[model samples]
Target: MLWPDPAQRDRLVEIRDNLLARIAEAEREGWLGEVEGLQMSLAGAEEKLTQLDRRQSNRSVVDLGIPAPATRVVGAVRNKSVNSSAAHTPVSLP
Candidate 1:
């Protein structure tokens, strides 16, 4: 499962805790089917958390060198001039 939002980690922890409690209750009540399903869900949650840990640990920063300020500013001005001139040009539809 892709946890895009950072808050989802907390939510996942809550879900895991709830599942544990449900599993315990199921076991006490002798609900074999409920116990089996909840156990599977708990396993999946644990696996997702493990995957998240591995992903976090493996993260590394890559440096793509920045362009010079003069080059960027010149290019932006040139593009704006071109765009503005095109917009204001009178079109003669024959």
Candidate 2:
């Protein structure tokens, strides 16, 4: 349920690179326990990067046009004021 912070992208990439380097060193020294722990951390960092990528992709803008009025105002008819009843009539949109 945690939202990804865009500001942490650079830090996460750095952490992933560091983890990869540590994993290589651990494997060379035959430190199986440390290698397993580093692998788990690396997985977490990579998952966060994936989340940021998804967030970036979904940052498009969409336009929702203005709302229409329930009843439109009609102009005066035959140089006389419009009837109150006619003025309050609901308009149907196409």
Candidate 3:
């Protein structure tokens, strides 16, 4: 999980709080589209905050300390014949 710096996190939270307050006022003003846009913005900010919180937590992996998931082949390579002498060759698209 990616974490933001303290100053950045504080700024984001401040912005989110301000947005929440504005959302209340917007509700009174009946700005439906504005409310919708602000809600999306708030959700994004909240998501980032959640990710930051996760980064701060001390989590233990249950999968035996595996850093990543296993890779599975989906399809075979299109070009199997390798030409070492033409490594830097570039093709022009029509």
Best by lDDT: 2
Model 1: which residue pairs collide?
none
| Candidate number that wins on lDDT, 1 or 2 | 2
> Model 3 clash pairs?
none
Q: Write candidate 2's Cα lDDT for 1-94 as tens digits.
A: 7977999899999999999999999999999999999999999999999999999999998888888878866985565566857887998999
lDDT of 2: 0.92
Clashes of each: 0, 0, 0
The deviation in Å at residue 50 for candidate 1 is 1.2
For model 1, the superposed segments whose C-alpha errors exceed 4 Å read 1-4, 66-94
Backbone clashes in candidate 1 total 0
TM-scores of the candidates in the order shown = 0.62, 0.67, 0.56
lDDT of 3 by residue, 1-94 (tens): 4566655898899989999998998899999998999999999889888877777785666666657877998988676468955777887899
Model 3 earns a TM-score of 0.56
TM-score of 1: 0.62
lDDT of 3: 0.83
Q: Model 2 off-target regions past 4 Å? A: 68-94
RMSD of 2: 11.7
Give Cα distance to truth, residue 52, candidate 2, Å.
0.3
